[model samples]
Target chain A: MDAMYQALLAPFIDFAFMQRALAGSLLLSLASCPVGVFLMVRRMSLTGDAMAHGILPGAAAGFLLFGLQIVPMTIGGLIAGMVVALGSGAVARFTVQKEDASMAAFYLISLAVGVLIVSLRGSSVDLMHVLFGTVLALNDAALTLIGLISVVTLVALAIFWRALVAECMDPLFLRSVSKLGTPVHFIFLALVVLNLVGGFQALGTLLSVGLMMLPAAAARFWTVRVEPMCLLATAIGMSSCVSGLLLSYHFSLPSGPAIILSAGVVYLASILIGSRGVLSTRNRPSRHRTA
Target chain B: MAEACITFSDLTLGYNNHPAVHHLTGTVAKGSLTAIVGANGSGKSTLMKGIVGVLKPISGKVAVKSGNRIAYLPQQSELDRSFPARVVDLVSLGLWPRRGLLGRYRPEDCDAVSRALVAVGLAGFEKRPIDTLSGGQLQRALFARVLVQDADLILLDEPFNAIDMKTLSDLIALIKRWHQESRTILVVAHDFDLVREHFPQALLLARQPVAWGDARKTLAPENLLRARQFHEAWDETAPWCGPDDAHSHHHDGEHHHHHDHAPDAIHKGAA
Candidate 1:
């Protein structure tokens, strides 16, 4: 038991940076997972992925302007993500192009621009840090930013819960009743961008949405309702973060990829043995009902 | 006759400015039950959307009585049925206008939702997710939602398509009850027989008003044929003529026959 504790828990207990990493990740998960669940429910999982990649240019711009500061990077990322979200929507509405195609186009451009900007001023090591994240090196400022974003996300979700759900399910019905339809949708997107920006520093641009969408997708196999699914997703995300952090500490692996891989493993396991999972045959006795 | 609840003056509703409902001029009377009947592309749904403020008229005015709340039930195809929501929660959304966003559901609100569910023969289905419901059951749930809305003006777009007979009858009874309460109801329906049996007034439409009065006469064989002809003759590639240009075209001999006879046909139905 002592050996197991030393192997699993000592790193977090003894090292401040490890503790900070865990705290940052746990906060990121709590804030982002519910947003991810909403994304899944709204069938906007790919949109979230596009937005994640879309933030890279903004973060890179922030880095160019303000050097590795948390506030500037977060603000930059938030602006970029919102622009992509709204731009894609506008393109879909006004032009013949569909939203997904427009989003893909915008994110690709953003990714290229972001890489170019980073490569111009920063070293390869610095570029790697930005792309893959520095979870093991979380400063107090990064932890504070994560914590603050988590609070904002939770509050926003609470306030917009009913409106958001109604918007997703039947926006026409919502619009017929009140004028909050468009505002609610934009606010929800803002929250999504906010959470993505929050998760960026801890998980990096490429892998941040993985922390969100994977746990959310995995949570679908375990539950049917929204609330329970959100809670379950939070659990899955936090566990993945903890286990991934431990693996990184022990095996000298890259923290961000390790965390995402841990989430992937959980997803795979859920698909196999979860209550409504693909491999769970309890719900399906035969191809056709016996009746 | 009661005062007009909804007044449309030369209304032309459309998508991308290509009028789906062209130069429609009419008034929907308060406390009256009206049925909008036409061919598949006859602009029944588009007119309903215009009434509910979903679509803006291309070049006309749709005036509603001030302080009169409107409840709209779109086609079931418009709803995301797979959304994760209990039947109770979905019905409770009807109270949104009164409660607004972020308002807590009071005890009476809960009671209203339960009463609505029970009224629709869904007493024990409060906890069931909407995705689990069948077509008929989902329609019932929607009707339950409209009931909780308690709006003075109600619009339903093809409320009975693919619905079972029993559920249809129940829904018809509910509409009758709303009528008894003096609510203005407009239903878009394809069942001409059902409309003649239950609705006193009807608007037969095919891109434009074919006839608009007594259900029995408005659905006349000649009018139905005219509506079909008008629908079939619609030019998909025609450039959107503005309201003024549309009026000019009405004077031209080719367009004059369809435009000139509409009100006369309506008057014939009234007489």
Candidate 2:
């Protein structure tokens, strides 16, 4: 028991940085996994990824201008992410192209520009830090920011729960009864951007969206209702965040990928063994009953 | 005449500057049941959208009586059936017009949702995820939502297509009940015999007003044929035509030759 405790709980108990990392990631998972559930149901998981990539250039630019200050980098990322989200939406509305296509095109440009900006001034190590993140190096400000974002997200989600679900499931019906659909959609997008910005501090722009999407996707196989799916996703995310940090500490693995890979394992297992998963139902035939 | 619930004055609704519904002038009376009848893509759906304020008129006005609540059940295709929601959750959304955003779902409201589900033959199915339900069951659940909405103006677009006979009869009975309650209701229906048997009023369209009023007369064989011909003869690339140009455009041989019978070609004062 002591040995297992040493392997599982010692790092966080022994080191201040590990505690901070655990706290920061747990807060992030609390907010983002719920948002990710909505995105998965709305079939906008790719849009979430694109928005994450879209933040790269602005974060890199902030790093360029202010040399790694969280405030400047966050502001830059938020602005870039909003631009990509809103700009692609506007283009899709005005032009003949669909939102997914427009988003795809814009995110590619943003990703390329972000890489170019980072490479122009920084050494490879600096570039690595920006791209892969520094979960172990989170300071007081980063943790505070993640905590604030989590609080705001949970509150906003509580308020917007009905309208957001209605909009996602049956937009035309919502529009007919009330005029809240468009504004609610904009607010949801803003929340997504806020969470992505919060996530980038720990997971990096490239990997931040993984934390948002992977557990949510996995949760879908286990539950049939939105609330349960969201709760399950959060559980999966918290477990991954905790275990990933431990694995990183013990095995010398990069924390962000380790966390995401942990989620990947959950997703894979769910795909095989979840209630509605492939292996669970395979080779089983049941007699049909009348309603 | 009864007080007009919805007044459309030369209303032209469209997408991308191309009119899907053109130059409609009519009034749907208060406390009346009207069936919007047309061929496929003949603007039956568009007119329903316009009345519910989903589609803005490009040329004219659609004046729905002020302060009236609307409950609309669009075709099932418009809903994301795979969404992770139960029948109870969906039906409860009908309370939105009453409870609104951030309002508590009171015990009474929960009772109302339960009653609606029962009314629509879905009492025990409340906990079932919507995706697990059959299409007909989904439609019944949608109707249960409309019941919970208790709106003054209700619009149902092709609500009965592919529905079984029992579901159809149950829904028609619900519509009749709503009509008796004096709600302004419009249904888009494909079956002419059903519309004639149930609805008192009808509006026929072939991207323009073909006829309006008296279901039996409006859906007469001659009128349906005209709607079909007008729908088939449409030029997909034709530009938007104003009221003045619409008459002449139908006469212009370069666009289409069959519409030259000018007197029969226009229903200038028919509604």
Candidate 3:
């Protein structure tokens, strides 16, 4: 354990790239967790996956055109994310198919498109690096992009929070009464796309969705209210980012997937030992209200 | 000093691009207890959606007096109770404009939610997850949602589709009290006897205002026949309501005697 701590903890504190990955991962997790819970509530988890896959070709294109530039790549990915959201949204509205099936079709085609593009450009290794990024490679630019994107997404969500929640819980009535129903819906999709793009550098496309979904899901074990769930998710996400970064540094493990796996562990633990989690004791005697 | 509070002047409503309810011209008097009754697919839900602004009218005006806060209770079937929302939180959504975005619950808002729950006979259910409730309990939870709206106008769609009879009566009594409080309430119902007993005014819609006025009287023999005819006309075989024109065209309907059909003639063609 001493040797393990030295290797993992020792380097994480001093290295600039490690610090960037840690900060970036925490922000991405904090951003995704609360939003992920709502998406799950709305039964749109698959839609999130679709957004990730859909953003891939854009990342590859941005790389081919702009090389390692964060801003251009982030923009390309954001646009692609919006297209996925809008495309899937159109399918959700116009077609008779359920959201999951439509999402599956969308992401499959898009992922294939990304893969084909990567192959065509003879940069499959570069594509893998883009998707499965290590903390060792993260720069100040990626961290800055994450910070700015987080602020924008957070502010936009904060502005429309109520309207968005109402739509997510039960849409039939809200859709009727709300004046900006369609706009609100698309704007939320846009926010999700933006968040994914923001986290693009630290988590890569694959781990971004996980960090968003799993931590929030883990927090669900502790609370029933939306606000509490959100707070809890942010806490869980931050813990994972910090711990996973230190662990990754000591062990020379990949930071992105390491952080995701840590979050996944927390999620499972919540599902098992959490206060209101599925496996937790129910029908407890009411003597201890505080407990 | 007095005018019909909610007026649908040549209004039509639909889904997608097809029309479900044709041009419907009617006025609901202020503080009136109105039941909208029709057989299944008689454009009853379509009419309810139109009234609530869930679905838009294709071409006509759905005018309501300005500055009215409307509390709406939708069909329970449409809500996802499995969500981790507590009954109190659900009720608290009624405090929307009052709570403002980022506004914490004031003492008054909390009191309102508590009172609403008590009114629905769900006083201690504040912390309960919505999924734990029975059908009757779910309906009561919805009643609590409307109560917190504190709205002068309340629109309920299929408020009692499937619940125990006792719970149904409990719901009706709560609604009656709201009506007595001078709030204009529009209930979407399938129970003929319930409407006859509770609502003095009704708009019996079979895609085209099948029968309007005097709930007890309009639901009578001749009116029921007209309702049946209009009901058949607005059946499922027809297309859905139109886009941006849900207010004016109903495809399944035909000419009717009680309602003025001048604007409806154009709607019938589109239908």
Model 1, residue pairs in steric clash: none
**Window of ten residues with lowest summed lDDT in model 2 chain B:** B254-263
Q: Any runs in candidate 2 off by more than 4 Å, and if so which?
A: A283-291, B231-240, B243-271
Clashes of 1: 0
Which candidate, 1 or 2, would have the higher TM-score against the true structure? 2
lDDT of 2 by residue, A10-47 (tens): 89999999999999999999999999999999899988
How much is the lDDT of residue A207 in candidate 3? Answer: 77
| lDDT (tens digit, per residue) of candidate 3 on B1-271 | 2356677766767765455676677567677778888877767677666666766787676777877777777654467887778888777777774664467778988999999899888989999988888878888887887787778888888888778888888888988898888888888888888888888877777766766767777688878886776434324566544553443434434433232223333343333
TM-score of each: 0.91, 0.92, 0.87
lDDT string for model 1 (A23-54, tens) is 99999999899999999998888888888888
Question: Which 10 successive residues of model 3 chain A have the least lDDT summed?
Answer: A172-181
Q: What is the RMSD, in Å, between candidate 2 and the native fold over all Cα?
A: 4.3
For candidate 1, give the docking quality class from DockQ.
Answer: medium
User: What DockQ, between 0 and 1, does each candidate earn?
Assistant: 0.64, 0.71, 0.52
Tell me the whole-model lDDT of each prediction, alpha carbons only: 0.84, 0.86, 0.75
TM-score of chain B of 1: 0.88
